[model samples]
Target: MSEAQDDDVQEFAASLTRMKERTDRSYGQLARRLNMNTSTLHRYCAGDAVPLDFAPVERFAALCGATPQERLELHRLWILAVAARQRSRTAAAEATGTAGTPPEPAGEPVQDPVSPEPAGEPALDPVSPEPPHRPWFRRRRFLVSAAVATALLATLGSLSALPDDDRRPGASDSVEAADPPRATRPGTPRPKSTKSPSPSPKTSSSPSAGASKKSSPKPGERTEEPSKGPGQQRPPAGVPLTWSADSHVWQAGCGHDYVIARSPRQVPPPPAPQDAETWAGTQNAVHGRQTLVEVSVQGRTSTAVVLEALRVRVVGRSAPGRGSSYAMDNGCGGALTPRYFDVDLDKDRPIARPADGNDSGVTIPAMRLPYRVSAEDPEVLLIDARTKGCDCSWYLELDWSSQGRTGTVRIDDHGRPFRTTGIDGLPRYSYDTSARKWVPYS
Candidate 1:
């Protein structure tokens, strides 16, 4: 191999290794995110292999949050490596003085490492396809965020490909071990990080004020106490909607409200009628204006749509200088955290103000969950809204547009898909919080 080509390979490997370390993700973490074997990723960083396609490389770089300048440099290095590889193959063909039969493709079972190459020579190997086992809920949160970021990147044209089949091996790839990996380097095997399912709040048949502060019982173990009277315990405020043990989905009786969270946690009891004054005042604060459109979520831009339904339901507007956001109110009465909310454009009633004090105070059998009003697809608005309620999680309102008509369907705030058969015999359906009825789709 020419000295110049060798140098290019080494430089590219070094740059990749450096950026990977910056991401603070273990090789396994990255492999899971990239949907490939850890060894393959290790090879890429070790300069043992170069992907024939730029798709995975581009995704890896973006997942690591590569800057434009860095991306350009990486692209340049990739080109050089490709040239170097081509030159090596040509030289080998010339040396043999015969066009040798092509080698079998990658994804074969791992054989013993071939003889080590001379120092400074690239160690080439056929790329393999074997994805390590991924446990349930393992790296789930991170995967969600990564998926969102990848989607955003694809949307922005930064990514060239996003195959639904993540495990597909690159058609053409050649590996050359540029150098022995250093002990402190990223490619070396490391222990996978342990992740436990997120904890759920304590579940009880009744809602209590101190539920959030109480330690939750272990899953499958519940403590039963004497049922408290209505005054002693908070009456179920929101209407009972849907509950699925398998899906961990809980919808309000008022409908159009849902929250996604860890399984078996305490579902916040319905909001008390007396406490209605607290959130009821929100009706006076804003309604009917599309002022808060064009908001940001996890750094990606989105537009908040103010539906005509909301405008007709309430007389209000967004607070000046406030961002449009939504989230589940767990009744904790604390600052709201940012969570994803999917609002449907075709089914949900637009954000509107409640009626007078009685109407506002009137308990709606709703979860009062949060939802993002806008999404990348105009038909489906994915909102990144916030809330001040501590007990609340987040909710999603599904948006669909057809025949020039748009409506929003209410999904659980967690954005989980509803099951066909709920606890009762009735088929699961989305609630129209505005119309105070079930949303039936043809």
Candidate 2:
């Protein structure tokens, strides 16, 4: 194999290996579940062979509990590996001059040749003689022509018997006008058709009419601006931006606290940051006092997108939940320099503001908005929303514009808003790493 081909295969194998390691499954275990030979599975993960079909790879990813994004990345790598393998095979075939060449037969077949007749006389059947035949259409030519002429004459006779007004121009329009109009609902108005009317026969035969018909928009074609009433603002047809919000971020200095309705003894030990979402779900936990979310935004096209501002919308507020608060980490030691924004949920009208972070005595500068992102350049924003008086449910609105088009994208925890409640004076507990148990903290 060429060096490039080898590299592509190895890269795909490395991704598979990482996925396997994350699942903590052995080769024999995975092979049994996948219904494949252990050695064959090993070869695939070792970059010794590539699967001809993607079905097994997809199943393998599902078995390893891979996320949607991870599965997409894996499929992309698999495509590259398959392409490289095909190229290598083609190169080998061409080098041996066997490409597109048909294989030769092993043996030749024998056949008998017929004898030629005498120079002037044609061969005759020995037993009997047969009569000559005529084609079916040729024998019925007169009948067929007569039938066509009779049909044409009958059509002309029928037309001549019609009334003169029925044959006049715009006769069809008069017939339509005699019918009653369609009835609409009492309070509802009929919607006007967006499509243009069909041209009349007189104008339809003109060059300009044909050109206009060709230029008209087809059915279901999206318009840049949809019809709307006055004083109303509508977003452009489509925005070329994509974003995802992860609410399972770890907040430093806050000690990674979460509020749950369960007791300290019922809750398990603190999970790693990556598994925080799963852990929270198992415990039915919500962020305590504050929640830190990580938002990733990227443009789907090559055009740059300007992120104007981040606004917070308060969905609702209620009394804080009466629950026990637990801290995932006893102490977090690291410099916080990420682009961060702070939202105070206790306010009547909350907004995202640039915030600075401090580690020990070093202060980190705050990052502001009006950032630019494209297909090649993506941006991540960290939002830290805190509440002290009530349990607040809120989501973020991101204003963006690209190529004179502007729109807003909502950032939330999946389809629901992020919830943060007051944890002051609540029963607090912390996980002790050495003891491997939850310990009450003041």
Candidate 3:
């Protein structure tokens, strides 16, 4: 066989294996469903040999529940495999200096033998067919490769141009698979995973956006006093504002428990805790704290709880360098934008710039803690940042302890939380004298 034929066959087999995995079925089950021998299915999956028929390839893809586009790609690969086989056969025939008659395709019925002409009528000689031109066939193969390259480039460009809001929960990723939440390195903030935005709670005219619903205190449990921090103030007196009826899941690293906080209005069943942590972490921030919130375990639901307050505090700053820089020519050829920076206030350290073209201003990691809020002291900052972007969004998280008690808070905002072009310490909400309104992150 020619080298090109070998490569195509291998690629086809690899794609088949990937499709089979997406079906979440065992190989034995697949073999039964496809009506093929176990060993034969194994060979196809193992890239030992390419199938000679396209019908079985299509059937296998259908049985594996491949999407229409996936099935189309599989069919394309099958065609390449067939072309590779033809080239290999043609090469072999040329090397042997003999015309190779095309073999009957697999799964076809054999024809009956023709009756001999009655008694010796003069037999006519059969006409020979012309051999295929080798050079022309080689050029056709080159053209096929060029077409494949163009298709790949188009696919990548479309993906790169997708808007941030187009990314939704349960939506297929670039690879069309649901990836587990990524774990962040200790001292580095956690990466944000945005789900479809549900309705947010009605923000009170008060400065704090989210309000925590009151939970009944445990029998004989001692409540701690509120701690005074820099620029801290007393919570307002009134009916504590209610949050929207929604549940939220925060993904931290391994050894850390999964948290699903629900508002007081809804009583959704809690999901089972994972047997193991989804990612690795140091568990540094939640240390020295006690578990105050009742989390959902495998088979039971917990009482609903709400967030008291979510705050943002500036902790550190950074200047964009080669590793942190973004495009100067973002379709606008005026003055170059300044270098970007990201700060993790909780860790009191600066983070590296994003490696993509999203022009993110800041990323606040999610935090889960063994903390509860006091009615009087509601100021607990989850995450804060100053960032740059025209059409982007970011997440903020803060976990804190006041007077030996602890609590958690989070925030989500469209666009950067801070102006990208402003001085480092300024929050995105700072007033802009030039624009006559709050500065835009863009």
Candidate 4:
């Protein structure tokens, strides 16, 4: 391989190692979580191998809590590594002169002309209409030879009539019969084989079939009973539920809050919520006090997926970063009625609870878990996560069940954990839209 191509593979491996280190989990543990071999994972992280499919790499990055930007970069590196590996293989094959050679047949090679026919002793002319004039003794010998050949042919015909089981192994006549030729006209149906068809690998080993076999749970293992009737079928190979989350979504009236590492004079006026990510990056800011996330979920098929519950997992916690809190808006008069969930990052066991609407005095009815959604019907959720004591990194686990299978999908700020920091005593400011400048907020 060229040095540049080798470096690409190493670069991909380095990225994987960095992500693995950030997770703080052992290779064995990560392998178990990913349903892969421990040694395979090691080879990937150690630059000894590259995966042909990107699914495993993507899953590994998500498990390591890589940010969206980081994931994108990792994917690009993976592409480069895969391309380089393929090119190297092709070059090796071309150098070996076996790139497109067909494999030689097995077993002993046949003689070129089968012993050159007994020194050509007056060979018979079977196709000739008349034989040359010969002595009486020669004519007599030819007649005897014809009689012997006829008897040999009769014996061979008898052997051919015997059943296949009685025939000797490796007989020259043991070749399989070929199919009859078919017309090549367009739209003509081809003849079907008389042999029985084999079972499809996908149908026999699909996830749904495997899931059905685990109906009886093991000791101490949590299992969801199949909700389908006796005749109902399971969903296909993968999870039917799909969802997307936007962590940059705005809170209805007060706008976004960012804790930026800059003084009032150094910071610029707040940007709109849609542009919050870029703006925060420019200002070296992190989430302040609360982070609002919008999540939309639906089923990929017609089967309904039941959203059982929303669970919170805290990845890490630290003292809030020191910075000034900048509120994107001074004040606004509006309300939103989308399903809302409040998350308290300071709690020992954080959970998502239904919250009421803001600013409109509207008391939203408490919506409990077990919501159903399908391809035609989708559900949107607004999450307002707040921290009062520490800077927190966390993500959500959405539990769902459909068509006799249950699974959990991780929800995050585009592959990374959603971060929210306490801002109780930070210098707070609000943008004066009329003046287009920052002003101190109580």
Identify the runs in model 4 with alpha carbons over 4 angstroms from their true place: 1-234, 335-338, 358-362, 433-435
Question: Taking the tens digit of each residue's C-alpha lDDT, what string does model 1 give over 1-442?
Answer: 7888888788888888888855424565677899987668878888878888888888899988799999999999998987898898799788876685433335432232342333453323336422344222233345567779988977878445655344433332222222232133222332211111111212355466436443322222222223344445332211111111112111221111232221212222223332321232222112111111111111012333323221211112222222221122222331211122323222224342222111224432221223322332112112322222122122223232222223332333122222110011112233344654433321
Ranking under TM-score, best-scoring first?
2, 4, 3, 1
| Ranking of candidates on lDDT, top first | 4, 2, 3, 1
Where is model 1 more than 4 Å wrong at Cα? 100-442
Clashing residue pairs for model 2: none
Tens digit of lDDT per residue, candidate 2, span 1-442? 7998889999999999888755424565587799987667778888989999999899999988789999999999999999999999998988886865433334321121132222453433334432234222232455567779999999999999997544444432211111233233222222211111111212244445534532212222211212235654532335456666677677653367899988877888887665677677767888998898877677766678888878888877998899999998776765544447988899999989998766446665676789787654456678989998899988777777766555555666645678999998799999887988889984
Candidate 2 Cα outliers beyond 4 Å, as residue runs: 1-236, 357-365
lDDT of 1: 0.38
Candidate 4 per-residue C-alpha lDDT over 1-442 given as tens digits, one digit per residue, 9 for 90 to 100: 8999999999999999999854424575588889998768879988899999999999999988789999999999999999999999999988886766434335422232222222334445545523434433354468678989999999999989987545343332222243465344323443322111111111223446645553321111223343345765533444566666667666663577889888888888766554566666566678888888777777766678999988788888999889889888776645444457988899988989987653256565555689887764556777889988899999877777877767566676544677899898888999777987788984
Tens-place lDDT per residue, model 3, 374-429, is 32112122122333311112233333333323333332221113212222332222
TM-score of 1: 0.25
Candidate 1, residue 163: Cα displacement in angstroms equals 54
Q: How well does each candidate superpose onto the true structure, as a TM-score?
A: 0.25, 0.50, 0.26, 0.47
Q: Give residue 231's lDDT in candidate 1 (0 to 100).
A: 44
Cα RMSD (Å) per model?
A: 26.3, 20.0, 27.0, 22.5
Clashes of each: 55, 0, 11, 0
The positional error of residue 416 in candidate 4, measured at the CA in angstroms, is: 0.7
